[model samples]
Target: MATPARTTQAATTRPVRYAPHLYNDDLAPVRKRTWGTYSIFALWMADTHAISNYTFAAGLFVLGLAAWQVFLALLVGITIVYIGMNLMGHAGHRTGVPFPVLARVSFGVYGANIPALIRAIIAIAWYGIQTWLASVALVVLAVQVFPGLSPHTTNDVLGLSTLGWAAFGFMWLVQLLILSRGMETIRKVQDWATGPLVWIIMLFLAGWLLIKAGFDISLTDSLTDLPASEQWRQSIAAVGLTIATFMTLILNYGDFARFTKSHRAYRRGNLLGLPLNFSLFALASVLTTAGAIAVFGEAITEPVEIVARIDNPWVTLVGAITFIVATVGINIVANFVSPAYDLANLAPKYLNFKRGGLISAVLAVLVMPWELYSNPVVVNYFLGGLAAFLAPLVAILLVDYYLVRRGHIVVDDLFTDETSAAYYYRRGFNPIALQAFLPAAVVSGVLALVPAFSAVAPFSWVLGVGIAGGIYYWRSGRVRTGPLPNEVIACASSSSTPTGSTPAPS
Candidate 1:
């Protein structure tokens, strides 16, 4: 892990004057960089080792492709994600800014809130759904271990059963406690619980399934029965969907990458985390699904369902609790942390990290995500809608940072509301970027919603990104620039705030 840089008294003699809307300790550049390669690795482990990821991998097997074909597609898709993340991580690692603040360099100072709120809303939805999923696992375990409790499971309250409410409320409180402690606690939980323990349970679960199936599992059995043309087409589409799964993280990776010690450390961590870790996870998921099919004569995509089917009480209990813990780790890293920073970025003066997190948690409940997840049509619509906005936003950021500005961000100017600041374009809005985003987003949304274009929906993120990025690059004249200017370098050297600020009293 990276060590904290010592703060010189000169750097902190008096805090720099900052606009009320633009500056807070939480939104400031990190002074003491502490995350290293393993933290990044563990982040991916936490994000990917959940019920949703497992189901996504198992769903790929049903796409009529051979196992080798699926693996190849995964490799290609993940490599693209790896490249995109490295590009996004550069700004954060160098400047010590979160995603939304980094976005101001491209979107303009106040305009950054548009992308920030959009990403935060998406995080809120997923946060509720993942917490609900963990609660469902708890419900399953409760029913199995104590059959007498089953009688009380169906008493309805607020669209959830009595027992469902109990489990959901419990998980909700637990997440709040974790979030209350802040990011360091989240990092430690993920680094320790998610990386090793969850993998062990998953391996054990896969082994049990294989043994139960007489060790005759085969991922390609169903695919071999399909026509060649269908297999090839579905394989390509599956790769697109796989890429879409990580689109949210790809856009906001700077939220975590900002804590890294260096760009080299960031890249090394992603190399191990994205392609390598994902491949191993996909393999295990496929094996587990094949085993389920061999034993039960039907594919079981959900790990919770697979655990519940086991007759051994002890095994079922362990699997259920492990999955609950895994979901919490993922929820904290992927959902909680992103919005905590994103929402805090929206109103820096009043809402610090903890208050922002509390707001996200409350909104998660208000959104009634349980109803959304229960309906397949609603889930698809929600995810498709998110893709439309997210894709264009990511494209705009990449184009502005890389091609337009030549990766030269004046860090101090990012927080200043001064009319002369480079980022204060047209009262804190970039017309060129908005022009690029709106049309591309409309086209992507149409492709996602229209049945005639449904086949193209899987690649909606790719299409939006490419279209918006190309348009922005064409409209914004390319400017070649070198390292930070002397003034910007001096500002960076002189500001020495702590990494994560102590939350304001609630």
Candidate 2:
């Protein structure tokens, strides 16, 4: 949790004649920062309480580790996430700027779009996958409620059934409607009800499964007997995989963190939400899955599948809806809002948040994520290849903000292309970032795409981050003329807008 020096309030918040190409109301410094610790906690709840996480958590149990070992891995992994998110969020909290805007400090005014578009494109793909996942729950509810709908469940169009398409469309529209309302609505829904409801539903499901299992669930029996060294290696890999799962959200944490009220509150919320909350959820998920094995004679990893087996329409309806809500929570925050900011950063003159969200939604459909999700090869090469770029970008941003710039951001320069501006290096592009990014991205991409390198694919993020950060730090030395002027540093540190001090207007 490095507390970067704050950009001056007047420089960031006061009205300035910023170029239309680089500035918009949504991308501008937040008018007020009022999100408290609980809100931040709920944000993680929304992010992690998803269908994917439920399945991922359960899958970790079979990774040749004991139940306690799995929990230990989860704690270690999420703690790393907690630390990374805090670091990413501090910049946003200090400057009241979104991720893409803050990115301009390192990537240059226009170069920022490179990372922005990459993140947005990846998020759009995930948005579709999550939308499809949520729609599956809806389809289950529809068939259960209307037995007549069974015939339509047959695959008819583009590998999706008529009912599936209808359900998907309905869910897609519902999410868009929610997103169009604004971030405030998103925060309230996720914080007040959606996250807690999932917890209650999951707890109920876990309790029911426990009763059905006669309290004889085994969390570790399925794990294969392996050498202690092998188990330790596997446990470490599990931790890496857990951290890798949140790579998308970690990169853009600043999008939500900009609204947080204080560093202390932000850290407290992250501590509570990430490692603590996820550990609790992991316990419930692992127990529920283990219970499924005891009763159903198989490890039922999918919560929807477990609900479907209950032989009660009411339970099915309630469980299906809860899964949908959980998926929706993650989709909007993790997939939808990120691309909205990223795409808006690309062309702020024309694309506001709502319009950007619309564009993302439409493009998600065009990607036909069912095809992508269903095909393992495509999932490996296509999505993985794009994702390989994220680590290096993360490294560059962190290195530039904390190291190269010494935690100083010239707020005005981020929006301007003037030759004299601090960030206007080599025509709105930082050659060092490009130099650092390309090789790291290439190596990660190779690891993701090459069949022979599959064994080491999981470590691509660590490799990319280390390589890019090192290169950027090394290359910056050549271009580093001197430290910023004392007055600039003083203005940033003495900014009137203390971190998260202002109350948001009602």
Candidate 3:
């Protein structure tokens, strides 16, 4: 008889032979779910303690609301994200597949590409934006350290300056090198870049600013006070924007959840990582910027600008490097990884993670994100538009997995185009799901873009989810064909092991 070790090895290796059109090592179900609670916690630590988040959080305080009101709004928004992440993460933990593959359960194998491409486009845009944000720090440092380089910052080629291009290219190359080593390397980078260093830096910045301001700062002081109705409206808008900031991650959370060891671990990780951690970081941002108003005679939302004003090279250098590292951590985890999996899902036979990631990076440069980032109107439009697009997709996937399918997935069928396969709907497209998603997305999109409906733009995600999920649930009940009874099911219960076809962690 074969030894148990050999038998286990055979079981794990066998699934690698799934259809070439869907079977690449990067796109395959992960064999080992090794990421633990701390890794999950660190993932959020990396995501939140970045320059963009700092600016975003700081911007919230000036929206004609008290600090406590902003916090309350953020609490509401973040709680929603925590719940959405858990719901989105469950299918990945059970099936050990990425977002694209998990999407195949509801969208047929070929039609899954629609959501995948949509997500990829969003990631690519943000990747460029974050890269541009990080490069700004480099420009600040370069001008400070080498005064002669200050002129190079002004001669704009296209939209960015000569120095801006150099800094952006350098940051891009650093990210590419880290990504070339794959997920483990990215996780390791996140662990180191974020954990304590970022928190320490944030705290130090807040403390120093408070000292410079003689501890005289107020969170209620707004640039322009508005009527109570306007205050409430903007506060609600703040909540919506906070939720919008996370819609991309909320939709494709399986990209991280697939690495988690158990459903319990995934929940524990998201609990610590999202609401609690994010709240503290938001507090730090508000405190630091409020102190800046007292000291600088004007409110400065940019941390790099605050750091630049201090007459200390060592402080500036450390701040720049830490911010850059923190920004890079989030960029790779949130932006780079999503598109890599998404693009690979488009053509698994021709592309894997590295190649897909490379394609994303190339597209990042072509988008000229600096122009997009500089315009406030464009940024808001971008956020509202993408949130509308993402919300429907997220709703469909969550409803199909937990309610409709009852937490069961025929993992093998997700890879096959066989006529009899459970997921292989007409020409590899699920008409019911498509019917539900299209109308909902279109309505949400139109509402966000139309000037008359501008008041509802911030709540686009809510609108899309309600419309899409409601329609899909009703349509799914009417449909005769669903999951085949005889196929292998990845057990959804927390207590039971997944089917034996899923390889156990070695």
Candidate 4:
């Protein structure tokens, strides 16, 4: 095991020559780690406070479990996510590298691109879906405010109506503008604007529904007609699904954590953002769903649908706009940022952050995510498949960082293409890591896709994580406790050896 080195300013401040094929400003260690507790807190706020999250929580309530049972599941599942996020985040905070760059330690400098592309593809799918979701809210508001637009909503073109296309285009443009401004601008927007704005709207909507329903809402009331045994089974399934929902973020959490000032700050933000914030959001979702049922005579799971049913046009408009903002916020943080860094890592010489983001955006549009999201069967298969691949990757990463390497990565070797460098195993690829990832991912994918293993499908993420982590751990042989090779203790101790300097050829 590599010994943990002393924290050093030289890691960030020293000037080191980087291989042209391996370095870019976006992939380098951050010189100024400006993010604090609130930034992380707000990041989760934006990520969790979205239409999809609201609907997912509301859908769980309709599974016939008592409110407390669902909450218990949420608490447990989110707690696990909290722990995972901390592990991933701490690595980035300590190493000062983004997710893809960090992966080079385990996956080999070049092999890391495989996982990076996989993650980037998933992000693109999500980016399109989220962008479409946000647009729906705008379409709803536009048709309500201007009756003339109703025709355009029904006149279909390329699977979407004219109004839908317009809304999607508008949303796509807005997100592009924000992303072009860079990560700091995104952090500021989430922290000060979208995060707080959505919370207020959610609280207000829940209160209004409660008051309108005559305060008769009860979480204990069964919403589904299923048998009690099946309800419990479904409840358990919901726990897994809930975890799967955020697995992507949990895996790449280091992307955001690298910007954080300290481990404590990251944990503090996660505590507020995951468990506390998510619990409150879940409660609001349940209450809002129950209230909608009582008043509307049917369960309205979608927030946009609920808002549309409101008699007050002004209030409805506000709700629509808020949902748009919330969805956009989540899309940028959860989907856009991950791929931007991942794709940029693929070819640092050619692609910078902005260019990578643009590629992702274009691919998102080409995929026509609206079609994928509109069909429930497709959405399930797509998300399940994503979990299958992602699960093993997460497991491998955790094992490599926490167990094998012992949280000690040679910062300079991460940017070197030389065969002698620690990360450049076998011509810049680690066959061991690939061997571990492939079979695990294949088995997990089979479980998700095969009907015989359908019952086990929900737990695909957990299963993958376990299988991959175990395989990597066992295959790597006995753990080593010696100090890491080429480890830089601190900036002051080793100013001569810059963190980005290229290593001599083997």
Candidate 5:
């Protein structure tokens, strides 16, 4: 008989694969596929069916454009969103990892911290802002239910009333409770929250517009006065801004896409979630905002305010629930999940998923996000600046993945301590990515911020992403990627030595 193969001794032999403990198995990919086309469809509903989204739809007319121009802007803007989502989804599906882990490619074993922090900070800020916006609805609901609350609302400080604080705190508690559970709970919650809002908003818009049509407020009234030149300029800006806004979601999308079963599943989800879903929601929002204006005698920018003024308690309640759901959906996805992964990235050894997210939530309150709520212009400017910074990061990552490695990474090496890990270029960090990104990002930032160059602000994200991608590709294209799963760092005593390793104890 052939001699029995000697089993590798545990003490003498290293493991063949490095498991990325970047996340708990709770997030591990499951073979049973769950999210279908409808669920994917509902995701964008939750994102776009909110109060802010409705206002944005109606406000597009403020660009002094015809209704057709507004529609064109919305379509082009959302199309870009569709494309960006797919681009990021590929990475999410490939390694079964989220944004922060995928970030390790561009940011490095340790350097991923920079992008992680940037993404986390932005998510927390938006979370607080969205939470506060949703709280306004709660405030209206409280006044509706308890007329006595009218008396406690008088004291105003720093652009918010005492009732606003009370409402915000209550909403904050509600969010904390939802987040107390893991992300699976959030996925289910979002599924339930979006559909009804879309239906109600659509029905409401149709009902109002029908009445307006009977009174002869034809579409022509809305279309005839728009100047083509101004409309085109605004529409172009709108398209770019919409793409940039969606790009932010793309940057951290692996956070959600990690749950996908296959690349096909990822693409299916993107098609349903982005293009189809966003298009319908944007149409509904625009119609409702316009119809509300015709019916109410003045434009109502807030969904809660529009619903509140209605005499039908049932209709108002439906609107209230819808807005609440939409707000919660964005809050969990954009705010809660992102910061959690980001903080976890920072201290994989220290903070687990839930605690890292909770820490972010708490600090968000301390930041007094209410300060940011007072000015929409300020918020837009800040968001624009952030997009400029992040676009470069995404560019570098995409170029590195697609062109440099030809869309391959040794996933196992993500957890390795080996000196020659495929990812361990110059001590677990890639300086060339940084070198390319910093200059491109800075240029984009200046363009966004400086008033004279602000006309091109809408294009900053694309410009930054492109420049960084090209620069990084130029620098690192010559380096050969190591073979096998990214986890296979060479043995500490292997031929290829990591340059930046701490010298063996002097």
Candidate 6:
């Protein structure tokens, strides 16, 4: 685990090339700023490339869209993810801190806890879901590795069969061991896992389809397989859902962005990481999924399943090993690490990053992850609900940072609980921020839950963002305002570029 580091004076005084918001008393800034656009590109490989992700993307077939329309929908949806990632990237680059500490800025010194916990809870839920999904591959791999284990598949207990329990435990223990080592280990492991996973899957997809479909199919097959009615529904839903899915992560991205050497580095990383990386992965995913249909005579959404269809033992073995590694990368980054920072943010005094993350990882086993994935319908509902939480927070932050503060932040005042500090808003919590969050979240939650609102409910995130921003502007008045200290000013002046209220130039 990364031990905390002190804030260097040069961090804020220079051209703000360093991570600003992330440097707290307890956590040190990442000493080496070695990650670049390509690292970020690989990071997305880890983020978006996964067994669950392929399932989710191809699940668009349920929306009744043809494969081509589904592809178009995916393109539109992920493009939004691209833009959202860019916005989130700014926070990371400007602050040089992780997510939880940076929340102190927009959420209020104490008020930040609410958003942090919200994000943490969402991360925990996903941790369970991702773990459950990865267990699918684990079970497949186990049965292949040790064929005698198959008899245990039917032995049911506590909803899951004995084999299911073993697989879940296998994934659980592996994640625990990986996570306990801390962020550095996670980063290096992620870089290694995602690259090979992609290569093997691409190879598997080509060879599988060439054997069955005679390599006659193209990536555009998904476009041709669409159902007019369902495809349209899913296409639009995918757009909104994609935005909602990635939007909250966008707001809290400073959790990692605080590590960059320059804002330029962050921007370069995001551009490579999001749109370009996401789109290409999505395309490969759909093609393989379609190829699975031709090869196996059943529509296979899971990549592990597609590889399992291979006849060669060595090919299947390579696919099995890569699947395990890929799921590890996705689960930790998208789930484990995020919740760790979130819970730590909630009670910085009681739970630092490692403890917070540990609590989340341990609790995941207790959730009976199998129950979480028992019904995909139930899973989507939870995702929609979690998407509701970020709206109000996003609205308040955008309004306060851009319209109110005009993209400036005071570093020291953020840490100090002193009455004189800029961030210590009366009694160390900002009611205005709270006011924005409650109503927006409640309404969005209801919209997401109710069947009547299904059409627009996928848009719950955007609705929440809009509602929060408008409410903050409407209610905004008479709050004290002033320029931050010389240090903040120095950072701001140095990073200045011609722009509007971006709050982040780099």
TM-score of each: 0.91, 0.91, 0.91, 0.92, 0.87, 0.86
- In angstroms, the error of model 4 at 123 is 0.5
| Best TM-score among the predictions, by candidate number | 4
What TM-score does candidate 5 get on C-alpha atoms? Answer: 0.87
Which segments of model 6 are wrong by more than 4 Å?
1-32, 61-68, 160-163, 218-233, 375-377, 478-506
Q: How far is candidate 6 from the true structure (C-alpha RMSD, Å)?
A: 5.2
lDDT of 2 by residue, 304-396 (tens): 889889988788888888888889998988899989999999888889899999999999999999988999988877655654788898889
User: lDDT tens string, model 6, 1-506?
Assistant: 23222232423332222123323233322344556556666667787777666777777653344556666777788777776666666655554456665666666767777787787777787788778777777787788888999998887799877888878888888888888887767667766767656766676675667677876655443434556576577678888877777765676766656555666766776777666666666666766666676766766777766676677777788887787777777778777777887776655556667787789987887777678777788887777787788767766775776566655565544554556555667676877777878888888998988889888898877778888878777776633254434324213222322111223342
By descending lDDT, how would the candidates be arranged? 4, 3, 2, 1, 5, 6
Candidate 4 lDDT, 1-506, residue by residue in tens: 12222222333443334676788777877766778999999999999888878887788887676677677777777888888888888777777778898889889989899888899989999999999988888887787789888988888888999999999999999999999888899999999877788888788878888999899877677776778788778778877887787888877888888777777889999999999998788878888888888888888888878877788888788878888899998999999999999999988988988999999999999999999898999887888898889888888988887787666567777777766677899999988788888888988899987879999898877778888888888888866454344544212111323333222111
Q: What is the number of residue pairs that collide in model 4?
A: 3
Candidates' RMSD to native:
5.7, 5.1, 4.8, 5.1, 7.5, 5.2
| Clashes in predicted model 2 | 0
- For each candidate in the order shown, give its overall lDDT on alpha carbons: 0.79, 0.80, 0.81, 0.81, 0.68, 0.67
List ranges where model 5 is wrong by over 4 Å: 1-33, 156-162, 212-224, 375-378, 479-506
- Taking the tens digit of each residue's C-alpha lDDT, what string does model 5 give over 451-474? 788789988887898789889989
* lDDT tens digits by residue: candidate 3, 1-506: 11111111222333212467876777767876668888889999988887777887788775556666667777778888998899888777777788998888899999999999999998999999999988988888788789999989988899999999999999999999999899888888787776567888788889998898888777666656778788788878878878877999988899888888888888898889888888888878888888887887887888877877788889889888888888888998789999999999998989999999999999999999998899998887777788899999999998887677766566766777777666889999999889989998999998887778989888877889999999999988843233445344554333222353332211
Model 3 stretches astray by more than 4 angstroms:
1-17, 218-225, 374-378, 478-483, 491-506
Worst 10 residues of 5 by lDDT: 497-506
Question: What tens-digit string does per-residue lDDT give for candidate 1 at 48-126?
Answer: 7877878877887865566666777787888888988898887667667888888888788988888888889899999
Report how far off residue 188 is in candidate 6 (Å): 1.0
Clashing pairs in 3: none
What ordering of candidates by TM-score runs from best to worst?
4, 1, 2, 3, 5, 6
